[model samples]
Target: MEWNISGQDFVTFSRFVGAALAMGLAAIGSAMGIGLAATGALKSMVRQPERQGEFVRTMFISQAVAESTAIYGLVVAMLLLFTTGGGHTDGIHGSDWVNGLRFLAAGLTMGLGAIGAGYGIGIAGTHAIEAITQRPEMSGVFMRTMFLGMAITESPAIYALVISMILIFVMGAPDAVGVFSGNIMDIARYVGAGLAMGAGAIGAAIGIGTAAAKALVAIARQPAKQGPLVRTMFLSMAITESPAIYALVVSSILIFVFTPTDAEAARIFGGMDLVAIGKYMGGAIAIGFGTIGAGIGLGIAGGGALDGISRNPRKESSLVRTMFLSMAITESPAIYALVISLILLFVFAVPDTMSWAQGWAELAKLLGGGIAIGLGTIGAGAGVGIAGLGGLIGISRRPQKEGAMLRTMFIGMGVTESPTIYALVVSLILLFVASSDVSTMSQGLHDFARFLGAGFAMGAGAIGPGLGIGLATRDALTSMAKQPAHEGALVRTMFLGMAVTESTAIYALVVSLILLFAVG
Candidate 1:
């Protein structure tokens, strides 16, 4: 049998997919979290029969908070399914494809936003149970801490809901015009905006989960020190959550603030408007992927530090200070990525009169900048996590060498960050540098070269540092394990090795910049 599909039909199909994804994924996550919390609460109740009412109440409250994300998703999905109607006509600027794309993005925004929240709520809820079971008297303090962490974790989901709302009610509205009108580029912008918050939220969830889990463990271990530990965790979580906020800001700007050129100009550019779409997409990916690593890295570092403090409560002050410093260092790459993304979003411009090749070149630069910074930071984040993990291990083994191990870890992490710096420089050059005078096809080719080169420079540059830092950390841990007394010498040697390993990434960065500006 043969099958036929019209544009209108495809648009309808897109709406269905969007509605399904938004509701399905969100509900799944919420169910999982609620189930997890309910099960934990039951177990806790069994353990503390007298405090059953308190356990049940806490679980219900946490589950309700978790369910809010699903509700946001459902509301968005329902709006997309019922509120919009029909498809684009030939004469209308809006196309069915554009409408479909908008719904697709809306679905992704809500769906992905719920994923992290679910995992986070589960982690937090499980810990809440443990906290209550361990010390029912401190249930009030534990609940407050859990609620705070869950609230922070839900911020990304809220951001996604906001973006979805804008896309459905504002941008995709049938009567909308100007930037909000559903043009190809505008649709791309909406999609990018959705992705920015959705993907960015993943890291925030993990970070919050890590902090929550550690906080629970700490509270159980030292109920008397709950105040200081909870405060520190919340502070760390605030920093960890900053990248998501940055992504949200960027997504909002892309959705509501970015003004595309006039419809006539768009008509003239025709398909070449893809260059504009590419720019927004690149910005989204840059922030999304860039922040994920930072989130996970902060979680690892913070969680490890909390574990250390719990194990060795006397060193609380030192461990907390070092964790803050390590988390800040780990966060630097994401911050750099945010800067690059902003430059791509706000600084780069393509004239309507420019040849298609020039537009393509501009798009290439935007995409290359995004990839360079985004991928570069992933490696940096991993390196920082590894270095922090090693430092934590070393400290746990020999608390006396906490100072030495932290110093060494910082030096190594700084070296690991070199590639991100190089990536940033190349991204800036790509964003700001103009293409040389050349034929249309040649300029396009040159731009493509810059695009690939920037990505290669940053990606390849990052490899050495990531591996070098991991190796340095591994050996440092080994050395510390074998010769705790000689930690000072081991740290010095590890730093030297990491510095040497990092040089290769610098060379790659130099090559990338050369490719970006000096070549073609």
Candidate 2:
């Protein structure tokens, strides 16, 4: 077969050219936006040197936001220009049209998302600057608020990237190929989708720099408020870069989602048919949801900790310790989510589900395991709640003692939450580890896996009680702190009460460990 390249496919070339023009426009937009924001802040600072701190902070944030639209456009434009999958040969014009339309959609999505993020950050940062100017002492609070606001604003951008990626790869590539009976342009669409998201790297870089500059200025103006300011900056940056993470996600989707469709796949790959789709879908779901769960859980944990710190400034050390403990516990839910996802990837999504004997049985086992992982979140939440509540109470009573007590509490709380971790580990192993001669040669390993799972289920269920007892301990400590003269008697009684409360968590761990190792 001889394939001839034709210049008549000017439509594809034109689309690429349009993408370049868009990129240039976007750069101009960013430059204008940045210049406008910076000039305003600089002029304000010149008019009022005392307000320099405020203006600088505001400028940094505004510039970051302002530059977003241009960056997004640039990303889309680049995608269009660079992504031409395989060598192009003369093909039907309809395919070129599809590719062109897809690129346009991608450009629009990125552009809109960037604009939204920019506006959001500008509004929030401006308010924060004004607040700081009025009350320099409250800079910490203002910064934290600013970060949160910026994060929220960036969400739309993330959504845009996600949509753009889908349009370019999932919808565009396949449809273009179908319309034109498989042309180079179709492949180009997929590659372009990935390239479009690469712009996220630029956004992230600029965002981080902006955040750092703001933080530095804030610190320079108010050294005492440095701790809170740093924390706020970290959080804001995390949120800001979230859009970039989405870009990464979209890129990944683009790579996999456009795989030859069912009909085409059969014609090209020639396998058991339905098996591939199931496996791919299952794996996608598993990884997608699992990581999402962790991210959400962590976000909640971080927010709660931040709130606790802000509310009890004197007890920051204790609050921080509690935060760490809470985050660790919170991570359990994500671990379960991961376990479920991994199972989808490894077990449920197997290339040939029915190839093994008793296909239905294998399916049941895989699905049941995933469900168990998801359910594990309940226990993780309970454990974190317990530790968080107790830590808060302790810090509230004796702010000065927060540091010592916090460390102790976290260690104890971590130990208390150990069983949940063990459960997650076992679940992952089952999901990923191949079932083979080991099952036949040594029932111990196989039996241990199942036993451990049951132990984890029970162990996870017990986290609530464990937390309740910890909270009770905090109450007792608070009571004793109020009356130091009678501390001995209270201490003795508190220990007794704590011991009783701890018994349940202990029992759960013991049982889980025994099940995990000794039973077989």
Candidate 3:
């Protein structure tokens, strides 16, 4: 049999794919997680015959919690499949492609995000069983910790849901005439917005999972210190989840805040030429990829801190304080990316009439600015994680010298973040100060070269500071652990070394700024 498919039919097919992905993937995850939890609980009940009723009750509650995300996905899928009038004559309006892409992106955002939440809940539930089995007397505390961790792990899934809702109800609304209207560029923008939040949330899921897993292991090891451990775990989870929040903010801005006004859309479709779609795509990539490193760093630092506190409960307060500071410092790079994305989306306006060469130059500038901030921050995040791990280890080994270790860690982290600051400066220059004098294709090529140079300057410069800060932190921690009494002097010396090492990053920032304003 031969099959004939028109363009409209393809749009219809895309809608079906979106609906299936949204509900099917989420349901699979929920089922797998709930099944794992039930199995683990049943096994535990068999081992502890007297607590069968309690195990069954806990398992049911956990399954209910895990099912909520899947239900949300199902609701969204149904709406897309049955309620949307994408196939109607008036609804197509040449915007079927945009609607199809929007639906697909929305489904991916919720569907993939829920997979992580499901696995996270399963990990937490499994560990909860082990913890309760080993320390029945502290089962109450274990249950509390497990629930809290699961809730934290579910945050990225919630972020995805919000993005999906925005895509469906706000952007794809039937009444919003001409919103999609066959503008392929606008359709791409919507797709980018969905990915900005959806793909970005992946790191948060992994980070939360790691933090929760560490918390359960710590509880199993030291059930008596569950209070402090749980507190620290929650705090770290909050910090770990921040990158996803940043992505959500960017996605919201892209969906509802940034777009062509009705008048602007009319002008674009009528003869006036404008080139700003690249800016939206650039902004999305900046926020989406920028947070992955920060998420991983938070996980490493938070998990290490929890482990350290479990080993030496006497240093709980000091260790937590140090971890908080380190996480904040580590987040600076992601913050820089957010700032750059906002500027790209809202501040930069394309000229009403421009040569193709000038348009290309503008695209290069926006993309270069994004890459400068996004790739430049990854190393800084890793550096901060290393410093945090060192601080945790030092405090656990020498509780009496926490003050000195914390001071050293702060100085080292500041040094590590200097490169990110430099990248921020370079990105600012590329966004606002770079010249776009492109009368010919050759000039546009030159402009592109300058933007690319600026990006590399910042990205490459970030590497040195990351390695330097990690080494400085390691040495300081080792010294404090070995000679607690000399902590004060060691901390002072480490600060001096870090300050000297940070000068290289500063030089690179200067060169990048020069390339932006002068060369480009």
lDDT of 2 by residue, 27-115 (tens): 55356556655665666666678878767877787677666666666766776667663223455444555455556646544653454
Error of 2 at 259 (Å): 3.5
Query: Could you tell me the C-alpha RMSD of candidate 1 in Å?
Result: 4.6
Pairing residues by index, what is the TM-score of model 2? 0.44
Q: Model 2, which residues run further than 4 Å from truth?
A: 1-150, 153-157, 160-227, 236-264, 267-297, 304-329, 332-336, 339-349, 352-357, 378-386, 389-393, 415-419, 422-426, 429-520
lDDT (0 to 1) per candidate:
0.75, 0.48, 0.74
Q: How do all models score by TM-score?
A: 0.81, 0.44, 0.75
Of candidate 2, the 10-residue stretch with the lowest lDDT total is: 265-274
Per-residue error (Å), model 3, residue 382: 4.3
Task: Write model 3 residue lDDT over 1-520, tens digit each, in one string.
Answer: 8565443565677767877888988886678778877987888988898988878887887788778768867977887787443543444543665667787878877876677677667767766776677777878887888888888888888888888877777775233344432264566578768767865676666677668867887878887887888888888888889998898888887787656566545443311122465577778777876776677678768887888888888778777877887788777777878888888887877555567677667777787787777777776776787788888888888877767777777777777777877777777777777777778988877877788778778867876676577668867887888898787788788878777777777777778877776553
Give the CA lDDT, 0 to 100, for residue 405 in model 3. Answer: 74
- Per-prediction tally of clashes: 0, 2, 0
Displacement of residue 81 (Cα, Å) in model 2 is 29
State the displacement of the C-alpha of residue 161, model 2, in Å, after optimal TM-score superposition.
6.3
Candidate 3, residue 322: CA error in Å?
A: 1.5
- True-vs-predicted CA distance for residue 415, candidate 1, Å: 2.6
lDDT of 1 by residue, 1-520 (tens): 8555555676778888998989887887677888888988888878879988888888889899888879988898888889654764433335566778788889888988787777777778877887878987777888888888888877777888888887777775333322222265677788899888888887777677778877887788787777778777877788778878888888888888875555532353342565676678889988977887787678777777777777677888777777878888888888888988887777766445456666666667778778878777877875786677677766765787766677777777777777777777777666666454444777677777777677757765785586467658756865785698787788778778877888888788778767766765
Off by over 4 Å in 1: 1-7, 23-71, 89-95, 173-182, 261-267, 389-399, 433-450, 453-457, 460-483, 486-520
